[model samples]
Target: MQGFALYPFDPPGDIAALRADLRGWLTVNQPQDDVVARANCWASFDAGFSRALGAAGYVGMTLPARYGGGDRHLLERYVVIEELLAAGAPVGAHWIADRQTGPLILRYGSEAQRERYLPGIAKGELYACIGLSEPGAGSDLAAVRTTARETAEGWRINGQKIWTTGAHFSHIMLALVRTEEESERNAGLSQVLIDLDTPGITIRPIIDMAGHHDFNEVFFDDVLVPHGALVGERGQGWKQVTAELGLERSGPERYLSSHALLAALIDAAGPDPDPAVASLIGELTAEMWTLRQLSMSTAAKLAAGEDPMVEASVVKELGNAFEQDMPRRVQAIVDCAWEGSDDLARLLRALLIASPSFSLRGGTREIIRGIIARGLGLR
Candidate 1:
């Protein structure tokens, strides 16, 4: 792969004050959930907390004020996200809407669509799920088989989307479907914004190994949505979805999702930890710092309106390795019992169960590496 340059993450205005203000808000508003829940905290759903955070002007920080947003800088939003992740705030309820859907709609959806969705999204009262993966497609988005035929009245959608995160609770879904009858691969595919409550749509939960209902299988049979539900140009879904993946992959969430475990490990180790524990802590800290720099650079490139697909893949790949390795490494060296109820042991157990899905979610490791390889002109 070619060398990647780091884009400086310099957000304008008083960043320190922003962090301080957010930290203060979190101190009062953040939930006192189980330490295990804090480990992969982004997936911890709390609707009330989401609404409160939105009311505090932290949910839709980057969108325009007319859309119920703060009209804040992208990097400003980045700082808020970092703080929220670090504090282990329950952001899952509005996470997809605030992070990607809101922006995607602002960029591609019609004015009417924007007016209908953006305000509720910014208020953290509306949620969205991605409708990309199908039964056999998985991360191979080009292989999607969901068909949406254009009808006189509207578009009729018929297909099943598997592994749809938050679909059970989300208000809407930005779905990729075959719009043209004879289209192949990525061709003739289009994005449609579907309301989850529409008729002929069924969302069944897919509980994870950790016993969490974060994933779901959504079925659509003759589901019809208005023509205006289409996002951006028809047959441009691949490009739009690629851009959305960049946002999904390059965030602080890539590394900070497992931060609670690190914090718990440190607390359990105490100041005078065993040499092995201290060494492991140092190693994990270094990896996290490196990931933060890479993720921040990718975010900066994105803020400047540049596509950082390869950079994002690199971040996701490395971040997944770091996260998946953390629990294993801790288990190997730490003397904590697997079934123990202590904070460190509980976090360790939770993360170990959760880490397996880290690489699989954004994109599989092989797929991500292939993207990076293609970026390097090696494909």
Candidate 2:
């Protein structure tokens, strides 16, 4: 009936029902103690709230039900996550674990590994953080110098990871470390699961411009993890991490991190906004809708058991650009006389402070563009 079929983005009735249920639950259970703090949205780490979400069976919706997960489709998970972020719920505590780590374990971890971690993750009791970017290797993961050497006891890890968000509060770290020195860059790397409380490990806080301590520098000094801690296989880290980054880059989180601020901007601008303000809102909303479709397409691919690496990179690159641009656009449009209603002023201020990090986190714009170029065979 058509030359080209429309790509599906709208959820089915069942999925719509799931979204409604989650929205209702959030209305009843979302924290009211600090609205400004909640404005951080997905970045607001609240362990107690995380546990509550887990108790509601909302944490690990896509993993195997045997591991205490809901065993729902990835699209369903996407629905839940987007609703949570849109509501400005505190999902930071279990975000990484549920989003990528659980899936990583399911795909590559041994049965024992999955059994050890998946249940707790589904329960939202065990928190995990990614130990990817280092001081010297931010987006260039191939330059990672953190080394895990073979020892009689196990693998002894020694190195530092920077910009490890939620590291301080997390129970475990899925760290990418170099297991071989002779191989070329990206060939010798491996991922290791390390207990954050292991001896000789240090976590130093890195306060952001907003004075938030979400990011941290984690140092491992002769820390020994059992051989069982290795995920997938040694020297296969580059492959594993590349897959994980696709998961990291394409989620609703990439685009929705600043959504609370966008909502606040609209609320502050009021119903009948100026032409300039209306134009700004219209542009941002259109961009967000486009990005959401792209992101959901990627999620659908994941549900279909396909890796949308190239598509994910595209979404991330564009989404990061839009997110980073939003704060400045709002600042330019809004009048200085328009003081916000409720916590709009505070959320706007926080968004301004945190905007600089939009392109840096996940992957830098330069790095993302490079990935896009490679994907298009333009490199």
Candidate 3:
């Protein structure tokens, strides 16, 4: 194909084959109980499950075959993610790598960088974390103070990154740093890959409001990285980072997080759906389907080499809000006890406890709203 600009694949394009294959594969090789364990703990800690996903060829579906990938369509990756989330599969171990870093690196990294990192990412043998947020820089990405200066060997990095999810265990941290001081907030910034074991690097797990240490604060003191560590052109981090955020924000993951409890609530309605409850479930399901379509379309746009920035923002804003509110609805439907002997009760117990952090994690509501306004030309 000379270019995909003229003909983008249809959203949710011909997923029948992929769906059937994934179903069969998962049926025979479903994850162990430890894979989908809920609450403060997750599958991210399970090396076995991560390896199994790699072995099963489900880790980096969209990457090229040379990198241990399946070379599947992006929509196929969508199907895989949907299956895992719907099944409540434990995927915490490789989630960040599979979700963001792999795709980000594949798109902007040098050929050597791609060859070096993508293979292990494909096999789920390597883990990666993003170092974007800091204690004072949440949502205002331009405020990140981490600095990297040219050194005889390469670059010397210094400063701290906070709210780096899974940093405690990740092998690599792809961090955004100020390459040179500029009067403009977004000027002279870049993204670089840092080895977690580099000299003078310290990672401290920060307990989230959820009372879990899934996130961390990483301090880098003169951590040296080769010049190749930069993912894209230096001073383009402002642009590259936003593009990466589009991928981060637009996906099934945005709304699928609360699906288990939503399904449970419908299950509690019994043999005959309660008219009111049925309508509520219908509304939620319709929203999920719509978000899925929008997200799929955004991927198709990206594959066609067109920026789906606006569409991605719409998906992120709506889908994240929808997912964030699902647990609140669950809590409102019944008492705080959630003692009913039903599937909804069990799922609600978990989702309710986990709901509060949903909005704050990926992109805060304020950040998303600003993006939406800018996209709409209302800002």
Candidate 4:
């Protein structure tokens, strides 16, 4: 196993003031939705709230100012993301665009593509979905079989993408496709920007156990896009997508999915609680603090332009365990009905239902553990 050091998470500027300001802003702007909505809050979509956040200069914090971004430091953006997730803000509508797609485009997209997409993305009105998973692919992105054949007219795409979150509502999709004929595994693949409204494209929702239509199935049949839709270098999609996954796996969202349940538990326990409940709260808090430190260190490494793939996998793996275990632990000790109506009971039920998908979203447990093992020279 390789030894790892925690990078310093010191961000320039008054982080205290920044957090205070954002808290104040959220106080005035955040909607008082159902308590259940606060659990897995990132999946709570609200387009109007997203636009409001963008208008407040919180949407595209790290992108260059020329593209209507805040041009702030990456850690500063990280602080904002932390605050938003902690507050259970309904940021689902523009989450992908702000988190990874916008940055990915800035890094590998064409000038025209940047000019066309970045502005809208910064505004938070435009949305994007990742087109990496297929029926059997899931987290095994290397197994992607989607194809995009270049023709005189344009690039004709014909394949299906499954479990694409927000595809039904997104404006665009950044897809990995087999660009070179006879390509196998990750070779000869390229990223392409596809407008969701393009002809011959179809999107159908797949409701989860929670009855949310966040995931979808996207289909492309002879769908043609311009030659410029290809992002970065051809035959380098594997590298680009790997970098994008680093961004996806290391954020605070990995652990904060069931935070509302924790908050509700604390509230239900009150300031003076039974010894066992107090002990449980202390343990959960300690675990959360540790995860935050790991995630912050990983984010700092990324901000310094280094790939912390191993550290990120570590965060994702541990964070997923923390989140999935939290609700079950709470249910085990708490005296709450299975379908209770109180805030604590409601949040507990909601998180228990949502917990199963936490490990599956960024990457499955087996995949994340495999990445960590490889990083340790064991694979």
Candidate 5:
């Protein structure tokens, strides 16, 4: 189908209602203090907050109603995600499960798998992380060496995954492993679900330069999982994961991580504002708005069951650039010290330190651009 079919990114009438309801619910339930919300937005790991969100019917907005989901359109979910990120709510706890995992299970999982996992996920009680990146294979997923050997009992996985976000706090891991022997890169790959508490598995936290501990290195030394743990067909991991990456890389989260900082910059500038600062903010805002429209279009494609790899890559590349650029550009134009007005300064300092990873996560800029190039038939 042509991209123009999803041309308009404007929210539908129901989507507007969703936005209003979510906004009102968040105002009453989430932290009223701007700094707290600003600091937490999507990155803060708060299980209780996630549970609250799930209970409020905001967690699984798109999954079928049969599996405890809201059975709404993807755009409805998009609105809730936008509000959460804009408020900087502590959504990290259930972000992965709600965003991609639930859909993955709904799409590829068996009846039993869906029955067991989707309900907990919709309830925000089950947390999962992607086990794709490794020490040698971060962006080049085909280079992954993690192997899962099938056994009479189950699959024995032996490999290591690095930079697994929220792995320490997660209950399950959807890991991509090589299941076929001597197969070339991108072939023989399969995705497996493993319980984090299973014996023979170890997790060590990787503290970032910002002193945060969300990243981790997970080791699987003959870790065993039941056959039910496999997500899809045995040797179709590459296909499944690529489709999943379309879900992972394209979203409001890709662009909204530093949104709090952007708002803070405006506050710091006050009325009249510096002409240079206003210009910079206006430029960034315009870029963000364009990216949002592109992102909404991508989401619409997904809603229509199309794997918009090229479009998703474009959004991710441009979104990452904007996210990484916002803090540095703001710092160049404004006072970044933590003194004087504390709110904006604190938000700026937090984001300034966190900005470096904006492009690194959700696939690096280099890898994203490569995907875009290939998508454009330039390769």
Candidate 6:
């Protein structure tokens, strides 16, 4: 809440025990999904697994019990998420909300908002999506032109949002909209809660570079929402959006999406690591570890309620770069007979093909660099 809470980011010595516990739990609970289903990665949504996590009190690991959460430490939550990514869990369904939307609502939403949203969110029954990027303004959030005007009844929203992850299946969207006039583009933005199924709202899937349909092009055509939908004060959206982005960027998931592929590569290496292969793996793994530590440290800052946006941007950029290498190095070395499945070769191939989107989807590397520079007070 004050600054990047990452200062005391290191996990407790009991992390090994936590890891063991998580492993045992997952061993009993990991969905027995078909390899083809698994290849779709986050596409499955895995409502069953999600409900299991909620039942285990693992979904809302860091939120207050008052909201039906587990009330665990922030770092403990980090451990769960990190393990999920490493194990290649299907987490895309509640990813954004679990990571930040729920917290964002708790921090900024009114009492009624909390009462209505928190329990469902905590139970993994409700899902959240973000509505920030637009057709021409993906990374340049300040360039948003979506307008919400107050009406006698509520607000009427009209604009189109692109690259909207989870919009198709999400219950709600934390939409960043223009609420007032601003000489500076970023100044008048505001975050609002928009119901996905509301009239005048349409969501069509957008197949990303990897030929996956996890994202969407969402259009708001005179969509009406109550004034209560606004998340915070009308003029404070920029700050809220930045806070959300910080939470989004600084997580183990950023660098570890392709970790399963990396493990597959290692397992395929029969007896000994080839000298060149070892160097490449070493380079990637070393960088991945560094990025992960940086990310976890940033998460530490966030857990303490700090902006840590600058730190997050640094980690995202670096981790994204490292993540991009999974496909390249795997392709160059491994003679795989498969693409992405139970077969190690197939898994490596899919990861390689999906590598290009690694840097683009979450936040473009360029946007991250600019944020880092701005964080350093550089123009």
Best by lDDT: 4
**Deviation in Å, model 3, residue 91 alpha carbon:** 1.5
**What overall lDDT goes with each candidate model?**
0.92, 0.85, 0.77, 0.93, 0.86, 0.80
Candidates 2 and 3 compared by lDDT, better number: 2
Tens-place lDDT per residue, model 5, 82-144, is 889988888999999998889999989989999989999999889999999989897787999
Candidate 3, which segments miss by more than 4 Å at Cα?
A: 1-14, 32-45, 182-184, 335-343
Task: In model 1, state the lDDT of residue 216.
Answer: 96
Candidate 4: C-alpha lDDT: 0.93
Worst 10 residues of 1 by lDDT: 33-42
Q: Measured by TM-score, how close is model 1 to the native structure?
A: 0.99
Question: Model 4: clashing residue pairs?
Answer: none
lDDT order of candidates, top first: 4, 1, 5, 2, 6, 3
142-253 per-residue lDDT for model 4 (tens digits): 8898899999988999999999999988999999999999989989999999999999999999999989899999999999999999999999999999999999999999
Clashing pairs in 5: 41-88
List the lowest-lDDT window of 10 residues for candidate 6: 34-43
Q: After superposition, how far is residue 338 of candidate 4 from its true place, in Å?
A: 1.0
Q: Give a tens-digit lDDT track for model 1, residues 1-379.
A: 5577889999999999999999999889988877777888889889999999999999888989898989999999999999999988889999999999999999998999889999998898999999999998986779999999999989999999999999988999999999999889989999999999999999999998888899999999999999988999999999999888899998999999999989988988899999999999999999999999999999999999988889999999999999999999999999888899899998888899999999999899999999988988995
Full-model lDDT, candidate 5: 0.86
Model 4, position 323, has a per-residue lDDT of 94
> Clashes per prediction?
0, 0, 2, 0, 1, 14
